[model samples]
Target chain A: MPPDAPAHLSEEQIISLVAYLAGGAGGDLAVGIGDDCAVLGGDQTGLVVTTDLLVQGSHFDLELMSPADVGHRSMAANLSDLAAMGARPAYGFLSLGMPARPTAAFVSELVGSMVAQGRAHGLKLAGGDTVKAPQVVINLCLLGAMGNLAPVLRSGGRLGDAVCVTGLLGGSGAGLAWLQAGRDPAEAAAAEAVAAHCRPTPRVAAGRALAESGRVHAMMDLSDGLAADLPRLARASGLGAAVEAEAVPISPAALAVAPALGGDALGWALGGGEDFELLFTCDPGEVPLLAQVVAEAAEGLTVTQVGRLTQGPGVTLIKQGEEEPITYKGFDHFQEPAP
Target chain B: MPPDAPAHLSEEQIISLVAYLAGGAGGDLAVGIGDDCAVLGGDQTGLVVTTDLLVQGSHFDLELMSPADVGHRSMAANLSDLAAMGARPAYGFLSLGMPARPTAAFVSELVGSMVAQGRAHGLKLAGGDTVKAPQVVINLCLLGAMGNLAPVLRSGGRLGDAVCVTGLLGGSGAGLAWLQAGRDPAEAAAAEAVAAHCRPTPRVAAGRALAESGRVHAMMDLSDGLAADLPRLARASGLGAAVEAEAVPISPAALAVAPALGGDALGWALGGGEDFELLFTCDPGEVPLLAQVVAEAAEGLTVTQVGRLTQGPGVTLIKQGEEEPITYKGFDHFQEPAP
Candidate 1:
């Protein structure tokens, strides 16, 4: 850090700085920062908007991921935010910055992947802006609608609510590890892990089903791993949570990569990020209903109850008959080493 | 350009490539790539969204513009797109990429400028993403509402509509020239021109009023100069335009810098970009109403009738009682010399 630079300010500090400067989104903006998506207009006819950026060196590497995968992941990151709000994806705006004039073929491949991913979730590429830059930066903004259901927020969790997560965890993290290790791409397990990291799917239908169930209290996507993101949901709801370590689902691919990486599969499942899966809170009695909703919406997808909300503030992990408080720390852009 | 670099493709070619690869925003997206803002939902209860990117080296220089100015201009660029669609500004999301760890004070200054500018137009800063990058990049996505009127798209102009522009032109272009020449910043004229270039205001009120009048047929903002942007509007509407060169409004500040820069004021007004003013079209009979609406909404701002739509395709400049077909060329990112 330079003499004039701030002392390794955390992501939370930067967010607070922005909040302090911006005050609050009064008037038309119903929900501002701290939520899965910014809510605009009223509940009757509202819009949920979210924006995410994918930097070349920080978020991805050109050597590891194809341009098509980059495009897909960029859109998926933003669409997942809308999914967390249970909003139906509607329109998208992509702003791309390239280091130099890329070939027409490259541009087509990148944009085609975006369009294809968007079409899967009923999203349309409405418009975007392009410019030359020092590196490739893709910023995607997605707009979604509440449809027949009201938008779900991260601040609705209550004490004793069941904390549940969709799909398995740590696959993306293990996949990233495998790719970084330069493992053979021809291996079936390695290929699966890499695909999980490169093209993680957003749980749009599952989110919509959960929202329509009227049982889900709080919801958000697991982008920064369970250890980091669950605390956000807990803090937003003015509560704490106790997650059962044994109940956390570690994918087969993650388990396979754990021994070679010299780390436990459970640790990766706890702290690994970029899963793009939904983590929600619902009434303890509604867990079965939530599972049914997910089963009906997406075949083969499982919703597991891994924890329960508590009245106290802060998250704790119950592992091996012991309780350990979890710290709130995600992938900080400034603090963490560049990928 | 490198042999594989597409030979420095023009901006138009890039746009066409994007259009071809993405196809069109069919189904829910009412208006797509060719318009100023993408329209979602129906005309009555629709949403307008637009995104713009500001690169540190390409769009602004740190030495020339303050952080506040960069923030203000970033919001202004997106707001101007909403204005072009005659929509009321609603919410905004900013995605910022910084080269290194920024100071708290610097972050506050940049975000404060964005909040202040957004507040002026009844817009609010909802949320955003931040990350470290090789250079500063600000990407803003603005969402707006039509508010009792249909969105006035760039393709609404007919064969006989009158072409008009709000405020003066070339001030920003001339300001860039003056700043590049290292003129004394203390001089009133020089300062005013620089301000125009650095902090050009979007004509939100004028745009809203025009849409309310139901007289303006088509609209867009002049960000790429008349010589370039007018052709876009013409091509979108499938009509030609005959612009009266003498009628185009050139700012006094532009005229003052022209001689020093060895350029004609009219040429700068026509070809120079970044004059964030409204360029709209209306029926000849409704021109008076359009002017009245702008006068009532924004005092001291002038709306000048500089051209009329023709039955053919392409833009022609009428000067000295003769018609000169205008070429379709503007600031192409890949082709233009780096600033």
Candidate 2:
């Protein structure tokens, strides 16, 4: 336990504590803890399973988002986990905790949005359980099938692997910041950020293409910003990473809001979360092949090489002529606001 | 929608609404909405999935049960769903919502109890997500596998199938009543009820035996009493049922507490929920073989024949010489209190 491991531990600390308590001795599971999804029965066709929770106030504020947006975002979060593993989305089970005496329209809208998203991703909502609570709680469990290949894992990167990210970063974080500032959503620059924050498109096609290329060695979705998540990938693979500050892609929306918040655009690009983009590692020689695979997928996505895995441990950043260690901190639920 | 459907719909009504919204047109699902677990594929080895939720005040009262008991019961609820499908328990994912600043001890206790139960039933706690909320909310998703046989579903019963229940009923409900009455747990009868309510066992071995014997046609866990759940099984199979009032298995603990609550033991036995016992349908001619199979499981569990499926549209209760249609009411979360 860390010095701050008390009643109000960070989300990462609590998850680590649980991982320790639940031991990594899964009998038939290929990958258990420290991965995006648990791999069950590692045959030609492996099953990858993941679960996510979206709570009222903590995950979404009803005042800011509609029920449909909440439903869609919750589905996207879980589907992104499957996409990280390069699995074909198959089945979904939802357990919803609703407020007492919720209206029929409320229930219908929530379920309809979830079903529509499921159909878009080829996932069928097969079963679910519901209960009345003080607020809305959406817990979705998704299952995906790995067809004729091993599901990609976070711990598969090598020392010489090139670190890359799919799509731009900082859009969702910028959107959240704009919303929190009580700004007009109709503002030209804020529109993109708000839309990205409300409805993130999971990089399913990009992830599948990367996984099928047989070049990508390790992969994971960026739910918790590149600065916080890249170190996790490094630690999992027992290596280190050196990210070039200039190479990190910053969205135009984030750039527009950076001056108003008195923060740099690059900071948001590195630390802002909920991007739902893929951060992966591959052999330096396979960059062109990986790009070709993404082109064939017709998703019009850009894969940017941001860093390289090193033989050392932990993550470092090269900004201008200075080199500094990157700290592991992001959008933790229990983390205190940084001044 | 029913005439009574409105803002304050009952739990069953809400579930029906969700099912309608989700739709039952599962392309590759062997069993979908109206079954204990959703069967993923119809091959020799099929995956069965189920999800359940335990809200703080709605599902369990902290004053009545310990954290460990709450954790144990939540796992039991999902395991029972897998048991109903005659599937081998495989993997589990738990998503927990905790109070904003919960004690470390509280989190540890809850997770420890869940992990212990998972190990006992050969289930591996693979992955999960946690969020902060107003109260503790537990949502568990379980996966099971049926080997070398098709998963038994609630729609498999025919008109001539006999309705049977494994183990006794009404114990958990009686236990809950005892606790709510502020009774002492030290009392012998109350102790049994309290134990049953706190740690109801899922009949996995019995379920496997019945499925292996190829005698059981339809099955589901009695989460919502015989009067309510039997109709569900019947409706799913496009059949009706006739239950004998005298044949319903009432526990001694329930009988002890019934008089104090101004109700009969049979009433508790008929209307109780959270029993976690298997209510299944089998061919009348195969009842003897099913009993023998249960005996071989060696838990000394009794398989009681309480009713039979009929070629009609609804359930009928045969009491003395009179017959009455059973009402579709049980422990609905949004239901009004009985006067």
Candidate 3:
């Protein structure tokens, strides 16, 4: 049978399902989502193109999500892809499907949030489409520039390069647990989790800074959790990696909230999704300078050296002086396992 | 409540909804709509973006349509938009939501038909997303280039210009009637009507020809049938039009089949929809030259001067020896009186 929704979910509820499934607009877009079409500004190195699809019941929960939050998330997802390629976003295209008669205000809120976010990041809203469907589906396309330099690819990480990440991780998974467990954590913690999920700040500045440093070997964003994404990066680079489990930074609030959900903060940090942080590999000698420059350039973002690339072809996770082989698996739309 | 569907309709039967919406992969699209994201092949003019949405039971009917035809028609609908603006079909991005496990092959055929049409016009299938939904929905974003020339706006037509059209009209409306009657005409006529419905060819080359000829004043594709669309062009261009009913070329086959279908051939020719033909205006002196060149360039296509632009506003129809206003209205998704 076709998926059945409530006879009448408020327009806001429907908007919440599709809006933040991708982040809203940014400064790069000239037109954004509300117009008949999005116009992209001209730039050097042509336009960087990328798209992603988010599915309801797979990528988000309408019951626990807000329309504004969904709007923010949709743009953020596309932005993260731009950040990974070391491209500065200029505009985006959004295509959404949901129930008919969704509130105009709800759609406006979603578009407004996207525009606000685009302005914050110097991205622009270019164009997109909207239609009625059973469940919510979102497709986001971002146009960016290669800037004055080349993009950092997953295949660029080299042996002996220091692997690192910007900012904390696991907060989103921990937050999700809190929501799922029926426990109302402190308002601050709840806010942090929701922020992580809804407004993941793509490391555009950090990525640009790292790309300019000329010392970084490769780069990517941490979205499908580290354990799943890191190995892909390593494999693409034709190398293996040894990660120090303890070196991975976890959100303090996530740590505090983990016990109540019967999960480990480390697991959340290593495997949590929706953490739109940068994970890059640089020369070990460049770590100190890299940290200082990245910190200054990215504001509150914290750069941490967490691992080292090796000659072999597998991931090794070090914990309490013991070594365990780490398997990499992230979110897959048609995959059987969520991890 | 949502619209009802015929019983015994399988999930695949429903997913045929978005089967045809092809996005324009403008001049610089590297990729679009079937992959991770649409890669823009950025150009000097940047990107001219446009999007449109089609919903099941709203824009089309599954009971009266084949999946492949639905798919082809939907894409043709959006391609018509790009043609209206004289944009080169470059790349397409699609976002579709439908009941899952729909025959993959059928989906492939629908998409393949799109790819075939795009290939015929030098476009690429970039990227898009698919998900499960009760009602099938299609969202198409077509990216094309403005070339070095500014886009020919809908409001560019002027007085005293000759209004011309490429190809005949009303075949799609006739095709719809045949489908409703549960009868498929002869293979030849069926092919013509089906082509009108399934793969209405967007007049990209013809539009570009008009735009580049330096003779055309304004242009738009006939989508909502000539009766409704002519006024839109006239309104946009701040001019009036006098369409000659006898001059409006009607297909001989459409005329032959009209009596049998208990319909007027003139009505279908004037008010039918989905003829993706270019309706352009040019100086009266340029009409002869344009007709010759467009005919030669768009081989197998006929270009005819069917009307004349007037100083005042609105549209008037002139029939043989009797020049009077014809109150001809075409299809409107929202304006259609409820059944």
List DockQ for all candidates. Answer: 0.51, 0.60, 0.13
The reply for model 3, stretches above 4 Å from the true place, is A1-45, A180-186, A312-314, A335-339, B1-46, B53-78, B94-107, B127-139, B185-188, B240-242, B256-260, B263-271, B310-313, B316-339
Query: DockQ: which is higher, 1 or 2?
Result: 2
Docking class for candidate 2: medium
- For model 1, how does the per-residue alpha-carbon lDDT over A1-339 read when each residue is reduced to its tens digit? 123435545667777777666676666567778787888764315678889877889888988888898888888888899999998898888888876567776677688898889889978788888887777889999888886678999999999999999999988988888888887655776667678888999999999989998989999999999999999999899999999999998888798877777756777688878899999999898898789889889886999999999986889999898999986478788877677
What is residue B99's positional error in candidate 1, in angstroms?
Answer: 2.5
Provide the DockQ value for model 3: 0.13
C-alpha lDDT values of all predictions: 0.83, 0.83, 0.66
Question: Which candidate do you rate higher for TM-score, 1 or 3?
Answer: 1
Q: What is the interface RMSD of each candidate, in Å?
A: 3.7, 2.5, 15.2
Give per-residue CA lDDT, model 2, range A236-312, as digits (tens). 99999999998898888888877776756787789888899999999988877787777677367788889899986
CAPRI-style docking class of model 3 based on DockQ: incorrect
lDDT of 1 at B292: 82
Q: How close is candidate 2 to the true structure, as a TM-score?
A: 0.94
- Order of all candidates by TM-score, from best down to worst? 1, 2, 3
Worst 10 residues of 2 chain B by lDDT: B330-339
